[model samples]
Target: MTKDQKDNLFLLVKSLTKSEKRQFKLYVGRLGVNQDSKFLSVFNVLDKMKVYSESLILKSTDVKKQQLANVKAHLYKQILISLKLNPSHQNIRSQIREQLDFASILYHKGLYKQSLKILDKAKELAIVNEEKNLAFEIVELEKIIEAQYITRSISNRADYLTVQAKELSELNVITSKLSNLSLQLYSIILKTGYVKNEEESKAVTKYFNDRLPKLELSKLGFREKLWLYKAHLWYSFLMQDFLNCYKYALKWVDLFYDNPKMINLNPVFFLKGNNYLLEALYFIKNKPKFINKLDEFYTVVNQSDFPKGENIEALVFLYGNFHKINQYFIDGSFEEGLLLIPQIETELIQFNNKIDAHHKMIFYYKFASLHFGAGNNQECINYLDKIISNKSLSMREDLLCFSRVLNLVAHYEAGLDYHLETLLRSTYKFLIKMNDLHEVQKEMIKFIRGLQDIYPQDIKKEFRKLLEVLKQYEDHPFERRAFLYLDIISWLESKIENKPVGQIVKNKYLEFYA
Candidate 1:
């Protein structure tokens, strides 16, 4: 190629937008570049176009764009030409090439179901072609997509169940639905290999040992296993099985140490950081000796550099969770919790402008929660409003929790009667679906307790009615705590009525003493 022609080609490749790049490829083909030298020039341009297109798709704001379809067509045409000239290109495996083109086309067409079907067929072809390594790659991609879908589904369902449980509580129906939902969720994670129990862990170890001879370790990526390990640790923590939490956490750390390259990938780094933070929190109550280790983990995370992406912003929120928990152990003070607000706010803005609607909702919820905890009620209300108004993001348990807390705070402090009435109605609706009488009573007591400080006479009358109903469900252990709170409220009520404060105090002491 002449220098001028080469420069022109470079500029064309560089300047073309994603759609225009596809047009450029078609234009190049029409130029009759059949000679070896001419074809070489066209191939270089196509290669550069591929790189540019891939980067655009990866970084694009609109993931649903049709840019991939054009690229897929271009790749398919090139592959067809290469196959006609020779069975395969020097660098491309014909079998892999064909499957990828098909998959890419299907993906771009917004037919993920069809795309996954093509990928499964391609996986079978890879196996038949004795391309086990390629098959593994296809498997990993399939799992990544499947796992994300499953996680989203699980989150949505959990949110629904939480809201239902709350609604049931208001109807005064005993419901253990949330606990049952949690158990079912744990079962799903266990069965999917996303989480492992002790039996499952042992079975997995034995299977790997037996299959190592046949398995290509290079192709059997470690990141998937690390994810499972981290999930197992979380499962253990949720179950309050501390030993298992410690064991699985150590296994997760070992995986990172054994393959430091895991950190080079964004997903792996996020998972690693998450697992480390979970471990640190697990040790807070039982293994206080590990506080220094937890600090070390935080230090490593703060120093580790992250490339700009949605996942990096996710890491920021995960770090926020870490810092929030660390405050609990470090000094048992709210200062550490306050310190995380600015960090979370900064990261929320970073994500708000970049990530998908789902992620934006997640960050908004976090920001709202942190603001509420920090006594920034108006800021919390603003963030909560954003989440509620986003139709694309479904309401979840976390959102309900924030809404309930915000409403209660607004009613008590700001005397926002409208918000208070809304909250009362919402909480009553939520409680109707709950079977756990204890939790229901606790929530009710909290509501009344808040009211006691502001409207003692009205709250006292309401509490008397609630306590009478709760006495019918006195089997709940938390009922005792509710009574204690009620006693405190009664004392405040008498004091508000101008009875001597000492008389109220003595009555509370006599009640406890008796």
Candidate 2:
């Protein structure tokens, strides 16, 4: 059954590494009776399966069709218990929880002193590591134990516990609120991109201010400050404030470097912070700092102790290669960047399951831009067509909108514009439907639409005029977002000057004398 093949247990079995599979079997051997169990039979069959089929499973194992569901569920739980006991899966959080578990067992056994001692150690570890949520739980257990039997001196233990609980509870509430606000802002950005107009800007600003909890800067701990900075960073992104994005992103990355242990403990957040920092630098066009920060990111991620889980590896691949390609765009070295495509494409195929459609399309856009810059117009159109023909993609509409605009340019450059009128009408309608036909896009579409009537001899002059018109919007608040998608100005210059767009950009960025 398709549903059977897509079940969580099937996927879980597929995700296990060889050693993990071996460990699961050895764990079963620990309880010799379980080795002959129906769940174990189901697991062994599923492990050998290239694809899950209810019928095949029924035939392979002693588990009957009626009992398959129960067996599969039990097997799933057993595998998880085996994984939970794995030494490789152990981390500080797990260790703290392990202590808490032992404390609970001891407490249930009426060993009050042993339980209290364990709880105290776990509470300290949780607080030190900013695991205050768990620390609060430990305190609650301590309170329960204290109520049953007082363990300490005449000083009020209840008063100390009450104060600790109250403080941690307050801090957790703040962290939760900030993190929620940050996620909401990020979702808005992913949905509609940066603030499109004054209406959207006003709405986002009001929402941010309304929900952001007020706090004293110096009173916050490491976790609270980290989420606080993230809230501001996402807000800055939604507001299209590049300088503020850079400022908050820097503070975010710096927070981790200031507390080195948190880096490995929270590797995903650390990678995300560095990625945002690199993005801010790219948006600001600061090549020097971008290069330095990118190098530093690669150095840190490649370190021996960096986390090696599947999801983290996927992110590292995503952000690392994404920035590396952006570096070529920043340097205007499209031809050099082309060398990376084959290898990247190979890797993308390998990461197909882990990476999402949005990121894949993003790389396609980057590839399209590279070809466009190097004057490989037909090649550029090839990539753009892949994006355009995908009718089901629900990525940010701006990506789709810009893809259409760039497709128009690539088609014209490739001399395949016999159907230019039809293409123009469809693209114009698409943008208008998305309510995104802004000035930069409007001018480009208008100029391209007017191309049919322009005399061949006057085309160069027309290109110059369009360039002058677009230059005014280079610093225009919302209009500039258009240029971030595609450098129409450079393309126009390339046309007017009769040079490759890549060369036009290279001359401006590369330090040839040095």
Candidate 3:
């Protein structure tokens, strides 16, 4: 028995929208001969099922045990064919590919004139849409046809095709190199997060410079510029340069706006660019600009012209809700933010397969912070435990380290002091092993550990002293990232002032703006 989630055919059936299901059924019945088709019956049985059971399938449908696999396979393929034919799936890329296929078929049939004509139009569309790779293929095909049938303007036609091919080939190579560098940097982030020390920074810098191709930015097309921005953005992020991250992220999103057509064509990149931009703003604590950028993202993605699909929908949910919750954190409205967690959790489950484990864990960390801000320390610990115990979360070592650190604070606040010594020791060991023992983390650990011996009357004085010490690092290049995670200054202020952390944060926010 296969689990419902593991069975691709069953999952595909579950993933279909009602309209898609209707279309699949209509498509099966189109031949009239397939009205009683075994594959159609198999599809119907799987569609009605919440879980996939091979036994149940055999019992419910005419598909025999031996033939069940084959029938299910056919049904899956047919449904995909139906989806491909759907108008919603027919984008410009698909249309161009279809034309290319038609042109190839016409060429094979010796219809050279019609084939060349179709190839010409398709090549133009491909170039306009930044599908240069496909454009190169069309050019290659034109060259093949032109070689066989000499045109009246053979010299000019050959020269034109040769130039187009060479230009497209060169541009494609640049795009490939930039894309490769961008993807490698992204992998580094997912594998180990930002560079932990000077050695790692040097290594990343070397890797980046080695792979980056030399080019004039002005001569690059939209796709090349997009990848270029991406490479630089990832490098800045890994180097912990928030200002550079903001600069490059701005360029990435602006490229789409400058070419509005690409925004609709490449909606995911557009959303991601804005998300990164907002993230940079969040790191710098520029709440006003963060809010504006977040608003702009929502407005653009909500437009009816934006592309719609399952993948893009998941990204919209992930990025949109993340920034929405982040706004609450910025404003220190933890109580209000708490209202969003339940709904967000529900959606998280709905998007479970689509959203990656790293992001899900990050969401848990945010929830923990929200609970901690509202003085619900035990609740905070609960969410933090989810992150700490997730052995499967291999990416974002920094997030794991911070979760444990925050867990220590939450445990102390909730009076769960019995495990404090053990947590402190384990967290310190983990940070050191990960080579992420920054000054903020070091100070935080020392202050928390020393709390055990402080006289009750002197605790407030200790908190004040620690706050003063950490204030110096609030703007430090590397150490400030710790504050980005835990906001220890505000936590200490809450203790000294005998107030809720949320109130302290809100006051600090007001002071910054003032």
Candidate 1 vs 3: which has more lDDT: 3
TM-score sort, best first? 3, 2, 1
Worst 10 contiguous positions by lDDT, candidate 2: 505-514
Q: Mark the 10 consecutive residues where model 3 has the least summed lDDT.
A: 149-158
| Over 4 Å off, model 1 | 1-228, 237-243, 265-270, 273-276, 279-332, 353-376, 388-391, 395-399, 431-514
TM value for model 2: 0.94
lDDT of 2 by residue, 267-326 (tens): 999999999999999887788899999999998989998877778989999999899889
What are the models' TM-scores?
0.45, 0.94, 0.95
Q: Quote the RMSD, in angstroms, for model 1.
A: 18.1
Pairs clashing in candidate 3?
A: none
The lDDT for every candidate, in the order shown, is 0.47, 0.90, 0.90
Q: Quote the positional error of residue 30 for candidate 3 in Å.
A: 2.3
Worst lDDT run of 10 residues, candidate 1, spans: 170-179
lDDT computed for candidate 1: 0.47
Instruction: Please give the lDDT score at residue 362 for candidate 1.
Output: 52
